[model samples]
Target: MSCAIKTKNDHIHTPRDFRGGRHVFVNGNEIRYVIYADTKKGIVKYHPHPVRLKKGSDVVYTRTLKGLVTVEFIK
Candidate 1:
């Protein structure tokens, strides 16, 4: 399987992205599913939503290099 992520393929992602030995096929593609394995397993559907601030909401925004932005908040 192919992936379009900036992180390395060997990077470990916890929980949902686990490392195991499993095989799945989709659209004539041979996917090698493994625990935290770097493959197309990261592919997921996207939900379109707008970012909005509500009343009594607390958030902090940080600007990083290359104009990247990070938002930190607590529930």
Candidate 2:
């Protein structure tokens, strides 16, 4: 899938624990971000250093990680 960031900046900053994934590119560089969600019981969950996602968009996290990290989503 392909996406774009609505920005004019030269550099984008993401969380430190992010991992690389299948990417959509703009001008040959990659876009990165993380996702956060809540379960049915109102339990908060986080995805650390997520990539290939768009801000303000909700996508099912398709990758796996070891250990615990607080993955937060930004719009």
Candidate 3:
């Protein structure tokens, strides 16, 4: 499966956005799931939340001192 990492403020407007095993992380911690969904307030559904990487998964993330987030996958 393909993996992606984006900033916490990134908007996921549709369920299809999660198709490639995308996972959102803030300050180096993965977000498990959005606790609640409020359609009236413009919250998207979280039923198909992104899958979390396993402990030994070949995942790498880097952030600059200025807070730029970068994600990489190692073979």
Could you tell me which 10 consecutive residues in candidate 3 have the lowest summed lDDT?
61-70
Listed per candidate, the RMSD to the true structure in angstroms reads: 16.8, 15.5, 14.3
Q: Write the per-residue lDDT of candidate 1 for residues 5-61, one digit (tens) a residue.
A: 455644333236434333432243433321222223433121113323445675322
Q: Give per-residue CA lDDT, model 2, range 1-75, as digits (tens).
A: 546544542132233424333232223333333232222222222343643465668764444322223222343
**Could you tell me which 10 consecutive residues in candidate 2 have the lowest summed lDDT?**
36-45
Candidate 1: Cα lDDT at 16: 61
Candidate 3 regions exceeding 4 Å error are 1-14, 34-75
Count residue pairs with overlapping backbones in model 3.
0
**Of 1 and 2, which scores higher on lDDT?**
2
Go through the candidates in order and give the clash count of each: 6, 2, 0
Which prediction has the highest TM-score against the true structure?
Answer: 3
- Please identify which of the two predictions, 2 or 3, would achieve the higher lDDT against the true structure: 3
* Candidate whose lDDT is highest: 3
Pairs that clash in candidate 2: 18-49, 47-71
Clashes of 1: 6
| Cα lDDT of model 3 by residue, 12-63, tens digit | 3233444334444334644334332222233322223344444787543222
